[model samples]
Target: MAFTIPEGLHPDLNPLAWMVGTWRGKGRGEYPTIPTFEFAQEVTFNHDGRPFLNYFSRSWIIDAEGEIIRPGASEVGFWRVKEKNVLEVVISHNTGISEGWVGQFDGPKIQLVMDQGYSAPSAKIVTAGVRLYGLVAGELFYAYDMAAEGQELQAHIWSTLERQVD
Candidate 1:
Protein backbone atom coordinates (compact mmCIF):
# COMPACT_ATOMS: atom_id res chain seq x y z
CA MET A 1 0.00 0.00 0.00
CA ALA A 2 2.94 2.26 -0.32
CA PHE A 3 3.29 4.24 -3.54
CA THR A 4 6.40 5.99 -4.74
CA ILE A 5 5.98 9.70 -5.29
CA PRO A 6 5.91 10.59 -8.97
CA GLU A 7 8.64 12.90 -10.12
CA GLY A 8 6.32 14.94 -12.35
CA LEU A 9 3.51 15.28 -9.84
CA HIS A 10 2.50 18.80 -9.08
CA PRO A 11 3.96 20.18 -5.89
CA ASP A 12 0.62 21.58 -4.75
CA LEU A 13 -0.87 18.10 -4.81
CA ASN A 14 1.69 16.78 -2.35
CA PRO A 15 -0.49 17.72 0.59
CA LEU A 16 -3.17 15.43 -0.75
CA ALA A 17 -0.88 12.40 -0.92
CA TRP A 18 -2.56 10.99 2.17
CA MET A 19 -5.63 10.43 0.00
CA VAL A 20 -3.72 8.21 -2.37
CA GLY A 21 -5.27 4.95 -1.21
CA THR A 22 -8.39 2.89 -1.24
CA TRP A 23 -11.29 4.10 0.90
CA ARG A 24 -14.59 2.46 1.69
CA GLY A 25 -17.47 3.22 4.02
CA LYS A 26 -21.18 3.68 4.38
CA GLY A 27 -22.92 7.02 4.63
CA ARG A 28 -26.33 8.61 5.01
CA GLY A 29 -27.70 11.18 2.59
CA GLU A 30 -30.76 13.41 2.76
CA TYR A 31 -31.76 15.99 0.22
CA PRO A 32 -34.66 18.45 0.53
CA THR A 33 -36.74 16.36 2.95
CA ILE A 34 -36.36 13.30 0.79
CA PRO A 35 -36.13 9.99 2.57
CA THR A 36 -32.60 9.21 3.70
CA PHE A 37 -30.76 6.51 1.78
CA GLU A 38 -27.92 4.33 2.92
CA PHE A 39 -25.08 3.83 0.51
CA ALA A 40 -21.68 2.22 0.35
CA GLN A 41 -18.93 3.95 -1.58
CA GLU A 42 -15.35 3.29 -2.51
CA VAL A 43 -12.72 5.67 -3.84
CA THR A 44 -9.24 5.21 -5.18
CA PHE A 45 -6.61 7.86 -5.72
CA ASN A 46 -3.48 7.09 -7.64
CA HIS A 47 -0.57 8.79 -9.34
CA ASP A 48 2.00 7.70 -11.90
CA GLY A 49 4.74 10.21 -12.53
CA ARG A 50 2.14 12.71 -13.62
CA PRO A 51 1.31 16.25 -12.67
CA PHE A 52 -2.10 15.26 -11.38
CA LEU A 53 -3.60 12.57 -9.23
CA ASN A 54 -6.00 10.16 -10.84
CA TYR A 55 -9.30 9.63 -9.07
CA PHE A 56 -12.16 7.18 -9.39
CA SER A 57 -15.24 6.33 -7.34
CA ARG A 58 -17.90 3.68 -7.27
CA SER A 59 -21.00 3.60 -5.10
CA TRP A 60 -24.03 1.45 -4.58
CA ILE A 61 -27.07 1.18 -2.36
CA ILE A 62 -27.73 -1.94 -0.33
CA ASP A 63 -31.16 -3.33 0.35
CA ALA A 64 -32.38 -5.28 3.33
CA GLU A 65 -30.78 -8.36 1.85
CA GLY A 66 -27.44 -6.57 1.75
CA GLU A 67 -27.31 -6.62 -2.00
CA ILE A 68 -26.25 -3.91 -4.33
CA ILE A 69 -29.21 -1.91 -5.61
CA ARG A 70 -27.84 0.76 -7.88
CA PRO A 71 -24.41 1.11 -9.34
CA GLY A 72 -22.87 4.59 -9.56
CA ALA A 73 -19.54 5.08 -11.20
CA SER A 74 -17.28 8.01 -11.98
CA GLU A 75 -14.36 8.17 -14.35
CA VAL A 76 -10.86 9.10 -13.28
CA GLY A 77 -10.14 12.82 -13.14
CA PHE A 78 -7.18 15.12 -12.95
CA TRP A 79 -6.29 16.97 -9.75
CA ARG A 80 -3.75 19.73 -10.14
CA VAL A 81 -2.86 23.31 -9.48
CA LYS A 82 -4.61 25.82 -11.72
CA GLU A 83 -3.24 29.09 -10.51
CA LYS A 84 -0.90 30.66 -8.01
CA ASN A 85 -3.31 29.90 -5.19
CA VAL A 86 -5.97 27.66 -6.67
CA LEU A 87 -6.48 24.03 -7.59
CA GLU A 88 -8.51 22.58 -10.42
CA VAL A 89 -10.33 19.30 -10.89
CA VAL A 90 -11.97 17.69 -13.85
CA ILE A 91 -14.43 14.88 -13.16
CA SER A 92 -16.08 12.82 -15.85
CA HIS A 93 -18.87 10.47 -14.94
CA ASN A 94 -20.71 7.83 -16.89
CA THR A 95 -23.98 9.34 -15.65
CA GLY A 96 -23.28 12.38 -17.82
CA ILE A 97 -22.15 14.74 -15.10
CA SER A 98 -18.77 15.88 -16.29
CA GLU A 99 -17.65 18.75 -14.11
CA GLY A 100 -14.74 21.11 -13.59
CA TRP A 101 -13.79 22.72 -10.31
CA VAL A 102 -11.52 25.50 -9.12
CA GLY A 103 -10.67 25.82 -5.48
CA GLN A 104 -8.11 26.06 -2.76
CA PHE A 105 -6.65 23.73 -0.18
CA ASP A 106 -7.07 24.54 3.48
CA GLY A 107 -5.40 22.48 6.15
CA PRO A 108 -6.67 18.95 5.62
CA LYS A 109 -9.52 20.03 3.36
CA ILE A 110 -10.22 21.19 -0.17
CA GLN A 111 -13.00 23.56 -1.19
CA LEU A 112 -14.10 23.58 -4.83
CA VAL A 113 -16.64 25.72 -6.59
CA MET A 114 -17.98 24.54 -9.91
CA ASP A 115 -19.99 25.98 -12.79
CA GLN A 116 -20.48 23.92 -15.94
CA GLY A 117 -22.67 21.36 -17.63
CA TYR A 118 -22.53 17.78 -18.90
CA SER A 119 -23.88 16.37 -22.13
CA ALA A 120 -24.33 12.71 -22.97
CA PRO A 121 -27.05 10.24 -23.85
CA SER A 122 -28.37 10.61 -20.33
CA ALA A 123 -29.18 13.58 -18.04
CA LYS A 124 -27.83 16.96 -19.03
CA ILE A 125 -27.94 20.33 -17.31
CA VAL A 126 -25.82 23.38 -16.47
CA THR A 127 -25.15 23.60 -12.76
CA ALA A 128 -23.47 25.84 -10.25
CA GLY A 129 -22.12 24.04 -7.24
CA VAL A 130 -19.61 23.93 -4.44
CA ARG A 131 -18.05 20.97 -2.70
CA LEU A 132 -15.91 20.82 0.43
CA TYR A 133 -13.86 17.83 1.47
CA GLY A 134 -12.12 17.58 4.81
CA LEU A 135 -10.15 14.86 6.49
CA VAL A 136 -10.94 14.35 10.14
CA ALA A 137 -9.71 11.60 12.42
CA GLY A 138 -8.52 9.56 9.45
CA GLU A 139 -11.87 9.82 7.73
CA LEU A 140 -12.95 11.74 4.66
CA PHE A 141 -15.90 14.04 5.24
CA TYR A 142 -17.58 15.95 2.44
CA ALA A 143 -20.50 18.27 1.93
CA TYR A 144 -21.99 19.44 -1.35
CA ASP A 145 -23.92 22.62 -2.04
CA MET A 146 -25.57 23.17 -5.37
CA ALA A 147 -27.80 25.76 -7.01
CA ALA A 148 -29.98 24.12 -9.60
CA GLU A 149 -33.71 23.86 -10.42
CA GLY A 150 -34.13 27.44 -9.30
CA GLN A 151 -33.28 26.49 -5.78
CA GLU A 152 -31.01 28.53 -3.54
CA LEU A 153 -27.98 27.32 -1.71
CA GLN A 154 -28.79 24.01 -0.08
CA ALA A 155 -27.03 21.03 1.38
CA HIS A 156 -27.42 18.37 -1.24
CA ILE A 157 -25.31 15.57 0.20
CA TRP A 158 -22.79 14.66 2.86
CA SER A 159 -20.58 11.62 3.02
CA THR A 160 -18.03 10.13 5.41
CA LEU A 161 -15.60 7.46 4.28
CA GLU A 162 -12.77 5.69 6.04
CA ARG A 163 -9.56 4.47 4.49
CA GLN A 164 -9.79 0.82 3.53
CA VAL A 165 -7.07 -1.69 4.22
CA ASP A 166 -6.48 -3.96 1.28
Candidate 2:
Protein backbone atom coordinates (compact mmCIF):
# COMPACT_ATOMS: atom_id res chain seq x y z
CA MET A 1 0.00 0.00 0.00
CA ALA A 2 1.12 3.55 -0.70
CA PHE A 3 1.51 5.90 2.25
CA THR A 4 0.88 9.60 1.91
CA ILE A 5 1.29 12.31 4.49
CA PRO A 6 -2.13 13.46 5.49
CA GLU A 7 -2.71 17.16 4.92
CA GLY A 8 -3.04 19.40 7.97
CA LEU A 9 -1.08 17.11 10.27
CA HIS A 10 1.50 18.95 12.33
CA PRO A 11 4.95 18.81 10.77
CA ASP A 12 6.41 17.76 14.10
CA LEU A 13 4.23 14.68 14.11
CA ASN A 14 4.86 13.72 10.53
CA PRO A 15 7.28 10.98 11.38
CA LEU A 16 4.90 9.42 13.86
CA ALA A 17 1.81 9.71 11.69
CA TRP A 18 1.53 5.99 11.08
CA MET A 19 0.45 5.56 14.69
CA VAL A 20 -2.54 7.84 14.53
CA GLY A 21 -5.50 5.49 14.74
CA THR A 22 -7.54 3.27 17.01
CA TRP A 23 -6.49 -0.32 17.56
CA ARG A 24 -8.34 -3.24 19.07
CA GLY A 25 -6.73 -6.52 20.01
CA LYS A 26 -6.31 -9.26 22.54
CA GLY A 27 -3.36 -9.53 24.91
CA ARG A 28 -1.89 -11.88 27.44
CA GLY A 29 -0.67 -10.65 30.79
CA GLU A 30 1.48 -12.26 33.42
CA TYR A 31 3.63 -11.14 36.31
CA PRO A 32 5.14 -12.68 39.36
CA THR A 33 2.90 -10.62 41.56
CA ILE A 34 -0.33 -11.18 39.61
CA PRO A 35 -2.08 -14.18 38.19
CA THR A 36 -1.76 -14.94 34.48
CA PHE A 37 -4.67 -13.46 32.56
CA GLU A 38 -6.05 -12.42 29.23
CA PHE A 39 -7.48 -9.11 28.21
CA ALA A 40 -9.19 -7.27 25.40
CA GLN A 41 -7.26 -4.11 24.66
CA GLU A 42 -7.94 -0.90 22.82
CA VAL A 43 -5.49 1.87 22.08
CA THR A 44 -5.88 5.15 20.29
CA PHE A 45 -3.40 7.67 18.95
CA ASN A 46 -4.87 10.91 17.72
CA HIS A 47 -3.66 14.26 16.56
CA ASP A 48 -5.26 17.69 16.30
CA GLY A 49 -2.72 19.20 13.93
CA ARG A 50 -0.55 19.78 16.96
CA PRO A 51 2.98 18.96 18.00
CA PHE A 52 1.97 15.94 20.06
CA LEU A 53 -0.07 12.83 19.48
CA ASN A 54 -2.85 12.24 21.93
CA TYR A 55 -2.97 8.72 23.31
CA PHE A 56 -5.37 6.58 25.29
CA SER A 57 -5.56 2.91 26.10
CA ARG A 58 -7.86 0.65 28.05
CA SER A 59 -8.10 -3.04 28.77
CA TRP A 60 -10.64 -5.37 30.22
CA ILE A 61 -9.69 -8.64 31.83
CA ILE A 62 -11.34 -11.55 30.06
CA ASP A 63 -12.16 -15.12 30.87
CA ALA A 64 -11.09 -18.20 28.98
CA GLU A 65 -14.32 -18.06 26.99
CA GLY A 66 -13.46 -14.52 25.87
CA GLU A 67 -15.89 -12.73 28.13
CA ILE A 68 -15.03 -9.58 30.03
CA ILE A 69 -14.50 -10.26 33.69
CA ARG A 70 -13.58 -6.75 34.78
CA PRO A 71 -11.98 -3.51 33.75
CA GLY A 72 -8.19 -3.38 33.99
CA ALA A 73 -5.70 -0.59 33.50
CA SER A 74 -6.56 2.57 31.58
CA GLU A 75 -4.03 5.18 30.54
CA VAL A 76 -3.99 8.59 28.92
CA GLY A 77 -0.87 10.15 27.47
CA PHE A 78 0.84 12.24 24.86
CA TRP A 79 3.59 11.36 22.40
CA ARG A 80 5.84 14.15 21.29
CA VAL A 81 8.73 14.46 18.91
CA LYS A 82 11.51 15.26 21.30
CA GLU A 83 14.21 15.33 18.67
CA LYS A 84 14.59 14.68 14.98
CA ASN A 85 14.56 10.93 15.60
CA VAL A 86 13.43 10.53 19.18
CA LEU A 87 9.96 10.52 20.73
CA GLU A 88 8.90 11.20 24.25
CA VAL A 89 5.80 9.78 25.90
CA VAL A 90 4.26 10.81 29.15
CA ILE A 91 1.42 8.79 30.57
CA SER A 92 -0.81 8.69 33.62
CA HIS A 93 -2.66 5.59 34.69
CA ASN A 94 -5.94 5.34 36.53
CA THR A 95 -4.05 3.26 39.05
CA GLY A 96 -2.25 6.41 40.16
CA ILE A 97 1.02 5.75 38.38
CA SER A 98 2.66 8.23 36.03
CA GLU A 99 5.50 7.44 33.63
CA GLY A 100 7.78 9.09 31.14
CA TRP A 101 9.48 7.20 28.35
CA VAL A 102 11.85 7.96 25.52
CA GLY A 103 11.86 6.08 22.27
CA GLN A 104 13.62 5.85 18.95
CA PHE A 105 11.68 5.30 15.74
CA ASP A 106 13.17 3.30 12.93
CA GLY A 107 10.96 2.73 9.94
CA PRO A 108 7.70 1.38 11.45
CA LYS A 109 9.28 0.11 14.63
CA ILE A 110 9.39 1.99 17.92
CA GLN A 111 11.32 0.99 21.02
CA LEU A 112 10.57 2.78 24.24
CA VAL A 113 12.37 2.56 27.54
CA MET A 114 10.89 4.07 30.65
CA ASP A 115 13.06 6.79 32.13
CA GLN A 116 11.17 7.31 35.35
CA GLY A 117 7.87 6.59 37.00
CA TYR A 118 6.07 7.71 40.09
CA SER A 119 3.42 5.78 41.92
CA ALA A 120 0.96 7.02 44.43
CA PRO A 121 1.79 5.77 47.89
CA SER A 122 -1.26 3.55 47.69
CA ALA A 123 -0.58 2.07 44.24
CA LYS A 124 1.85 -0.54 43.01
CA ILE A 125 5.34 0.77 42.51
CA VAL A 126 6.40 0.23 38.91
CA THR A 127 10.13 0.90 38.75
CA ALA A 128 10.89 0.52 35.07
CA GLY A 129 9.57 -0.84 31.81
CA VAL A 130 10.37 -1.30 28.14
CA ARG A 131 7.83 -1.30 25.36
CA LEU A 132 8.29 -2.31 21.77
CA TYR A 133 5.75 -1.52 19.05
CA GLY A 134 5.82 -2.09 15.36
CA LEU A 135 3.66 -1.95 12.29
CA VAL A 136 4.17 -5.10 10.27
CA ALA A 137 2.22 -5.96 7.14
CA GLY A 138 -0.52 -3.55 8.27
CA GLU A 139 -0.88 -5.07 11.72
CA LEU A 140 0.17 -3.49 14.98
CA PHE A 141 2.17 -5.65 17.36
CA TYR A 142 3.52 -4.74 20.77
CA ALA A 143 5.20 -6.23 23.80
CA TYR A 144 5.92 -4.81 27.20
CA ASP A 145 8.34 -5.83 29.93
CA MET A 146 8.24 -4.29 33.34
CA ALA A 147 9.94 -4.33 36.72
CA ALA A 148 7.83 -3.54 39.73
CA GLU A 149 8.12 -3.72 43.50
CA GLY A 150 11.12 -5.99 43.97
CA GLN A 151 10.77 -8.12 40.85
CA GLU A 152 13.07 -8.08 37.83
CA LEU A 153 11.89 -6.91 34.46
CA GLN A 154 9.91 -9.64 32.77
CA ALA A 155 7.49 -9.96 29.92
CA HIS A 156 4.19 -8.59 31.06
CA ILE A 157 2.01 -8.05 28.02
CA TRP A 158 1.98 -8.89 24.34
CA SER A 159 -0.67 -8.16 21.74
CA THR A 160 -1.45 -7.76 18.07
CA LEU A 161 -3.83 -5.01 17.06
CA GLU A 162 -5.67 -4.19 13.87
CA ARG A 163 -6.46 -0.61 13.05
CA GLN A 164 -10.09 0.05 13.86
CA VAL A 165 -10.46 3.74 12.96
CA ASP A 166 -8.03 5.46 10.69
TM-scores for the candidates: 0.81, 0.95
For model 1, the run of ten residues with the poorest summed lDDT: 1-10
Candidate 1 lDDT tens digits, 61-108: 766665788875455687886555577888887767788888988667
Candidate 2 residue 129 C-alpha distance from true site, Å = 0.6
Can you write out model 2's per-residue Cα lDDT over 33-137, one digit (the tens) per residue? 999999999999888888999999999999999899999989999999877589899999999999999989987899999999999999999988999999977
Candidate 1, backbone clash total: 0
| CA RMSD (A), model 1 | 3.1
Q: Cα deviation of 123 in candidate 1 (Å)?
A: 0.9
What's model 1's lDDT at 156?
A: 72
Off by over 4 Å in 1: 1-12, 32-35, 64-67, 73-75
lDDT of 2: 0.91
Query: Could you give the C-alpha RMSD of every candidate to the true structure, in order shown?
Result: 3.1, 1.3
